[model samples]
Target: MSENKGNAFDFKLFKRLMSFTRPYRGIFIFVAFAAIVMSGLAVLRPFLLKLAIDDSIVPKDSEGFMTYVILMLVVLILEVVFQFAFIFYTNWLGQSVIRDMRQKLFRLMTSFKMQYFDKSAVGRLTTRAVNDVETISSIFSEGLFMIISDLLKMLVIAGFMLTQSWRLSLIVFIVLPFIMYATRVFQKAMKVAFEDVRNQVANLNSFVQERITGMKIVQIFTREKTEYERFQEINKKHRKAWIRTVWYNSIFFPIAEMAGAIATGLVVWYGGLNVIGGGAVTLGIITAFIQYAEMLFRPLRQIADKFNTLQMGMVAANRVFGILDTRSHIEDNGTINYTNTKGEIEFVDVHFGYLEGEEVIKGISFKANPGDTVAIVGATGAGKSTIINLLNRFYEINSGTIKIDNIDIKEYTLASLTSQIAVVLQDVFLFADTIYNNITLNNPNITEDDVIAAAKEIGVHKFIESLPGGYNYNVKERGSMLSSGQRQLISFLRAYVSKPSILVLDEATSSVDTYSEELIQTATDKITKDRTSIVIAHRLATIKKADKIIVMDAGKIVEEGTHHELLENEKGFYRNLYEVQFADGGNP
Candidate 1:
């Protein structure tokens, strides 16, 4: 949530925002045309009143008065019609623009490398995609289009006033400089206030989203009071930021009303003097001038108000655009498209770090041939998961080449490469959707029968069938309704159905119970039957049957052999880890 730190309005940023509306140019153009028409219609009302007063009422002709009154009604009806059209088109244009922007923002975010999300908060990004885009909607719905219509009305009214009585019009113009100056001051103050408000809003959204998502942890640790106090601090800042905007509004509006009142009084006094002088200004003209003065100054006040909406929209645009402009993205320039990968992975002298110059995977080299099962064993942060990340190209390696089927992995399109790899993490995540949808992930090609077949093959179909609605049963958010083992079994079924060439189980069963772990172990045996699989786990029992065992410590591989071969080395890292775990009565 970055603050817009420039003038009240950043024209350059605004122009960039307006570019998103190009796709809906036709609707936007119609909206502008409607504003012009509405403004013209609004100005005509005062002129019609003048005509009725001088030509019908003053002459005391009842028939002419009726005709003029009907004409005034017609004008009012037309204004109402055009005003409706204005509202419709402006809102349509707003919805259309934000719809495109929100989609683009989501697409852009999803395309970013994992490194970007590694540092960014989920709630902050959610705010940008949902809340900030809604603010941009206000730019058209309540701000820009309406401001244009109001300004046009003011200009047209001023033109009419000049024609009717320049003396009184000049009196109205005298207060213009003061009001304009006050508005400028108010706008600058409000802009700062609004930026603060938006920033605090994003912060609050981030805090609440994180707290709610991690509520189990809060309650388990008995931290409800502590978390509540933290939330209060953030809530207070949000309130204070908004109150600042309210304070500015309070100070500015009264000044605008006073200016409008003074302008009206001056028009009355000057027009009365002109009429008393017995030559130019008529009663109808003085009366029209008073109405014209209100029209002229009212928009000035409204423009100040609308400018706030416009400024908030601009700030939102700035924040949304900031993410869109981020270069923290993986360049998907590879043109190679391999539909069926052989799944022969080779990491040659791969050196990489999530942060600069601090290697996570330090000069590591490994190879997994087609249909081979390679298990990676290491202490936490010993670069075991980092190896899997690099293999999948989630993060770019600092130096060295990772090849699949003897071709550089960088040469293949990301989709073509990633489509062949399926990963199941320890913390399995399921959507707030049905069990079938969670397994299929909305893939149109993955039929319910295919999911059931895959589930049966992986040994979870019986468990799923036992649930209410079976495959159609809702898993709720992140599979909250299912046990951890049940969720992991679903993850296995999902991977099994994908028919991936390479399978990765990154501590996939580490968090499940004994019954679930046994079920998952059976699922795992079926899923890894004929794939180039990389299994990274502290649970040595899961990988004892793997073809090759790679042992690592302090970001380097210390042993490479079968489970029995590694165990024969008494001084080996794998042997020490296995001995320590077995002594603790842990399955290994």
Candidate 2:
């Protein structure tokens, strides 16, 4: 995320934001009408008072005075009603707009290429989707429509003052230029200040989110004290940014209040002179002008404040739209809707890289015939995982043809292709949800009976039933409550239930204890039977029975044959790797 420069307010950006209101135009128009009515109500009160004082009170008509007071009270009650309507509907507008925006943003993120997630920090993305989206909500709840209402009310007040006495109105106008000048200065300063404030807020959010999520790492490394110092520095930046806005506010408001006071004082002094001089300006007009001047200048003061809020919203919108504007998602232009496959897979001259000019999978080629179990053995960073990512179209290849059933994988719709293949990642992720939901992913078609039967087939039914809630048990965030083996069992069961024709297990048995490994091995054997299975394993013993073994080094296939055939070659890459693991007392 780049720091936001305190540039001029973007009306084009603002106009784009206002388009979200189209969905709630009924409420929008209602709020607009309410602002007009409220402004009229505000203007009417002063007019009624002038009439009450000059006509009813001075003429000594008690009945007329009471009638005028009753009318003012009625207007006051109506004003309160309209104000309530305005506030409630405006807030509704804000909430609705944000809800829609949040959904759109999340949907966009869901389609982004895996490479995008690889490069983006989890904390930064969270800040954009959560904090920035929330800030934009203020445009409706506090910024845009509210500012419009205030401006409308201010204009109405000015009009009423002029009708009362043009000369007195001119006197009041003299103070406005100073107020306007101050407001202009305040507006520019606050725009930049708010940009800084919002940026700091995102940084603070990102820092805090990362720190909390990685607390275990901090504790294990004994870096808590160092991290705390770092947090304090970031926290200080956030505080300093906010304090600047508060400082600007303090300076601007007092100046506005003083200016309003001076305007009223001028109207009072000048009006008093006219009344004493027996001129046209009356005491009734003077009293009304005082109220009118405050009404006029109060919104002028708030306009500056509200404009800063608008600036904050614009800054947030700019960040969020940055994400929406990215075209990094995998291209899914394939029109073929293939839901089933014979599972014959081929990779021809495939090349890929996470970064430009740094190919991680270099012109690799391999094939897995239907019902064949092919094992890929490689050291870390040998691009074993990158192969599976490309096969699933999580990232596009730099140059390659990946085919299933002799049709380019890109010739199949992403869903049609992915639905036919299920990947069990090395680092399995489970949502904070029930075991059943995690396994079924809330798919309406995958029933509890289906999960249970599949779990039984995988020899993990008893394992699940032994838990306190059995399949209904809740796995707290990221399946933290479950052991590594247990989570693997759940992941295997999830893939089993999906019934994908092509199954890829990426280091499924690498990180678990012996008992867990045995359970996963049993489940893997059961699921891979008659399915096109691609298994990447660290243990040579796991892939011994695989029909073919492709040994990779530095992203290239250096040895290709069965386990026994590769072992027969004394100097082959697989033979050497196997001997090294055996020498290290590792599974071989």
List candidate 2 segments past 4 Å from native: 1-7, 584-588
lDDT of 1 by residue, 1-588 (tens): 344464777888878888988988888888898888888887777887888888888899889888878988998999889888889888888998999999999989988989999999999999999999999999999999889899898888888778877877888999989999999999888888888998999999999999999999999999999999999999999999999999999999999999999999987887788778986888888788778888888898999999999989988898999999998777678899856567898989989998897888888888998989999998998999988888788899999999989989889999988888999988899999999999889999999889888888888889999999999999999899999889999989998899999999999878889999899899889988888899999988889999999999878888999999999999989999899889977655
* Per-residue lDDT of model 2, residues 1-588, tens digit only: 334354557776778888888999999999999999999999989889998999999899899999999999999999999999999999899999999999999999999999899888888899889988999998898999889999999888888777778999999999999999998888888878887887788788888888898889999999999999999999999999999999999999999999999999999999999999999998789999999999999899888888887888888998898898899888889999977668999999999998899999999999999999999998898989889999999998999899998999998999889998999987989999999999999999999999999999989999999998999999999999899889999999999999998999999998999999999999999999999999999888899989999999999999899999999999998988889889967645
Model 2 TM-score, 2 decimals: 0.98
TM-scores for the candidates:
0.98, 0.98
The best candidate by lDDT is 2
Q: Please report, in order, the local distance difference test score of every candidate based on alpha carbons.
A: 0.89, 0.91
> Which residue pairs show backbone clashes in model 2?
none
Model 1: which residue pairs collide? 541-588
